[model samples]
Target: MRKDLHEANRLSWNAATRAHNSHKGDQAQFFRNGGSTLFPEELALLGEVHGLKALHLQCNAGQDTLSIARLGADITGVDISDVAIDFATQLAADAGIPARFERADVFDYLAHAAESSVDLVFSSYGTLCWLSDLNAWAQGIARVLKPGGRFVFIEFHPYAMVFDQDWTMCYDYFNTAPLAESGVSDYVAESGDGLAVGEYQAGEQDFVNPHASHEFTWGVGQVTTALSQAGLCVARLDEYPYANGWKGFDGMQDSGGRRMVPPTGMPRIPLMYSIVAQR
Candidate 1:
């Protein structure tokens, strides 16, 4: 298991390293450019976090980490990508935000963190899919939380993964097969950069080899179950019909900076969910 995880981490790290390096210095810019604008609705659900001790798992390049710091949380961020961590550390230093960034697998970091050391465990979009084992992931979350500490997350709806292109749901909800998606740019790129249109780097193309990318079709039931199994009692679970980030769905419109299915209508399935669980 350790060997498998190590290999998986390597692949994910290598792929993410390039993206992290390219945008390392632009975290604040990204935020100011309407990054967290869409997120505030869901993020606001976390309530008052001023002065809280927060841990962000899979914190890529630390944009959200710094954003949370701006909210007054003493923050620590962990990611498998060394490049991401290095950039995050430098950004923190340059911005004068007192954030600690660490390079470590989430599981390893949680397993070894001093027990009950965090006031909150936070993760967001695109973070959980890389993890292969939810039970282990849950256990790690449980181990790190102090009594009454909270775990909050906002993730892409598993149902959104069913479609390869707009207007079709081609995949099974229950399938656990590792879907190898290649030849696409990193999801963060803007149009017309010239690398490959949607490709990651402008003027440069590279393949991202994700060692293990499995989407768990976790409905509300599964999400709550996993949190309960992890010993965190569910405090609140809220779902939104729209997403704060691009979800590759057709007919979805950007409203208040968030992507939403138009009122004229698409099926009202959730596009994102925020869960707050307490230890």
Candidate 2:
């Protein structure tokens, strides 16, 4: 199981690296237009971090890491993707942003980081599901945090993960079994154009590889329990019924620039959650 998890991490990080390098142009726009800023409503939930040492876990391409740096935090972004770390470092240097990025597995990185070195640990949307063991993940978070430090996360609601690709209800939300692979297009790459595969840059094709996609689902209660077991006090939790970013649902509309199930006009169930916890 440990070996399988490591291999899964390697695959995910490699895929993310290729995706970031190939889709840099679109991704930059995506972030600027609110991809990294997906939970704009929860920005204030992170509270103040000026001059604080912050670590960003699973920080693909460093958008959110740089975003935190812009707010005056001394930031270090760790990802399992060397490609992503290279691009992120270059991007930060080019933008004159003072931030550092490293390619390391989250668990390995946390294990080696000096205890109580970081004042804040931040992660966001779509990050936690990639992790196979919640307890180990939580322990790593606890190991790296300073006394009274905080860990903040914003992620896709597990309830949303239970829905089938057709956007109709399916599957057991509480089931812990690994899900079958969905050979669908990347959520961020798919817009109103309908399932565009392979990235495009300056009217030309960028990287294209089929072995680079994977997905997983995790329950909310399970995640909270892991955090508690790690000795973190849950500070605040908020669920939003709407998402301001791409949601993998057909017939979903980017209503007024925010993504939500539409036309049927149902008050969309909470699709995402943000949590703040203290060590």
lDDT of 1 by residue, 133-194 (tens): 67788889988889999999888777776766565779887765544444223544322221
Cα RMSDs of all predictions? 4.4, 4.0
lDDT of each: 0.68, 0.71
lDDT of 2 by residue, 1-279 (tens): 244655555665665455434434554445444344324554687678898999999898787788788778999999876677887898777666789999887878888999889889999877876676788888889888999999999887889876776777897887665554523234445442221212333222333444433455668888899999999999888897765565566667755545555336565687878889999
Point out where model 1 deviates above 4 Å: 1-6, 9-13, 20-38, 183-185, 190-219, 260-265
TM accuracy, model 1? 0.82
Top candidate by lDDT: 2
Off by over 4 Å in 2: 1-3, 20-39, 180-185, 192-209, 212-215, 257-263
Deviation (Å) of 267 in candidate 2: 4.5
In candidate 1 the C-alpha lDDT for residue 13 amounts to 63
